[model samples]
Target: MTAKVALVTGATQGLGLALVEGLAARMSTEDTVYLTGRDAGRVAQAVEALPAGGARVRGEVLDVAGPHEAGRLAERLAERHGGVDIVFGNAVMRVGPEDDPREIVGAYAEVNNFGTTRLLRAFAPLLRDGGRFLVVASSFGTLNHLAPALHGRFDGLSSLDEVDKQVAVWRDAVADGSARGGDWPGFVNIPSKIGQVAAVRALAGERREADLARDILLAAVCPGMMNTPTSAMWWDVRDAPSPAQAAEVLLDLVFRPVDPAQYGGLVRDGEVLPWR
Candidate 1:
């Protein structure tokens, strides 16, 4: 049997762990799913707790927020498996209401935007034909939240470099207090989320012509408000679906035949959101 490989980042807890569980349950003995986290002990525990039967579960130490971690993992996976079938950019940084919005933009950019972009840059080439790359993102990732000019600027970007440049522009505005008066969104999370989605769009556009023949798919997916520990920190999730439930939804996209409609879009509950 040809071995199938999947990688889920930040899989030690919450939604990431649930995605790992969902993937493991669907894969056969010949397949493998790598569950990664920053801490070795937690990664091991998460792998051990998975019920036996589906895919072979393995633990890996990974921190997407770290400078060189994503690139290293891509290299290691390429050397060992030649390529990967699924790549989940599930790692994230949570911001609480009390945290100063301006003060946290830099941190959020590092993890939420740059980290995810780095993952795309590294793992995109390693995605096998018909493979999928999906980022666990937010519905707030739409460009409609920005001022018309800003919205147009982001929507017009054709490369990841342009997205990075725009994010730097926002960061500079925040540092100088211009963001307060400028038409920027007050919350740091909005722009960070937008940057993530925009990067996905940019990369997808870059590979569109080539990827069509290969049947590869890539998108930024919103798992909705799941009743996970991370979400409970920021909002009330009493009625939200459990992480496992959300994972099932994500896995549907992961396993389904590629849909041209969803490619490079901000997907939520099986629909591509309008950018405007």
Candidate 2:
């Protein structure tokens, strides 16, 4: 494979670490793979845990939701590597049942929703010709989560602004305590997941409109159910595959050349799921 520069956010553990490990094995020695997390020690440990490989694995301290960090990392990458070939937006906050709903609202709003927006804004331009940006999203993010009455509101979503409007509506509902019994999905994470997928679609459109010579492929991918710490927090994991197993599946898809039909879609197990 050609020397490529890749970045995977929240790579200290679980699926994120699995992705980094997979990439490290496939990449050439000249290639660079950056694994990032908010914690420096954990990031270092994750890098150290990787098996010996040709790829140059580096750890970066990055809080995707924190202000200006993604942009700064983008600048550094631009200066050092000219641009990046692959980006995996995998950082997320998974809320638990014991957590206070009010206290956790900002995490879902900022990390899951706007954190994705921030990653796209900072890294989209840095994608080299034929580069790919894949968001680690869930099937739950699909438009099927929306009520029938609200489906029309998201139709023909063509801009980030439109996605933001949808997020704002969810936020408003939450603030008013109407989200539970109203048109919105009861789970706070649902709207943010929807926002992530919608944002990826909108950004893909914007990239096409720019008409750049680069064929930058962008999409959201669901890695299916994994028996990771994060997954075990919410659901039964006995039937789920190990993080390494799911990573193998996901990396297989990532390494393949994606056709236009796959772009901007929510992919799972090599197939694009129905958005509507």
Candidate 3:
């Protein structure tokens, strides 16, 4: 019997590395897991750092966000096992230095949103009939908490929704209007308290191949602001979970009964979040 193989991207440190460890712990006797990163050295480090008695794990170098790298990974996997059984898109970029509201719109969208689109495009087809797809996202994607309370009024006017409608209502409030200094409203109240997590939701909403491809497990997990070098101020954040704990909580989902084929679209904090 051929062993099931799993590929985890950005398996260097933080949530990615922790997940690699946890998955290794759960691998069956005839299973293999591969950890991948952009750099060869980092991949080596990830392989060496595998849990003491985890599965027979190995590491490879592949930047999932790049065409060349993803292609090479596809080639290697096809040659080795014909296709992969699982893919953990557990890589992301949070806010920039000091969580600058200024960079939130562009930088975060570029890395967190579009980058994911590119990676999924590259690897979704390589998944075997029963492969799982897990994407590491943030709690920010919830979009349910965009309260009018947080985002303050612009030019002395309140209501965050108004700003959102600025493009439609005011006709160019973004270009020639009082919405100038307040470029990114996140500074005032961070309306998108859950947009990052919502990105996973959005992708699942738009395209739910992971769940549909096979009897596969598909999830979008919020690792919970764990103590990771993800951001310099991780330690300062109020009680943060350990990467190991996050990993454990994430994997525990596999056992809990949920239709992998039905709700394979999204997962939040281990539960499948609404894609509606």
Please tell me which predicted candidate would have the highest lDDT against the true structure.
1
Tell how far residue 161 is off in model 3, in angstroms: 26
Clash counts for the predictions, in order = 0, 0, 12
Clashes of 2: 0
lDDT of 1: 0.87
The stretch of ten residues in a row with the least summed lDDT in candidate 2 is: 208-217
Tens digit of lDDT per residue, candidate 2, span 132-162? 8899888988878888877766667888778
User: Which parts of model 1 have CA positions greater than 4 angstroms off?
Assistant: none
Candidate lDDT values, in order: 0.87, 0.84, 0.57
CA RMSD (A), model 3: 7.2
lDDT of 1 at 45: 91
Best by TM-score: 1
lDDT per residue for candidate 3 within 1-276, as digits (tens), equals 668888787788877787778788887757788888878998897788666664668888876445366667777788888878777776555554466444344444334444454555556667676666666765544433334542232222222233233212222332244444444343212323233333334445444554555555555665667766554443475466777877877676644554644343346565555532
* Better-scoring candidate (lDDT), 1 or 3: 1
Q: Estimate each model's TM-score.
A: 0.95, 0.93, 0.71
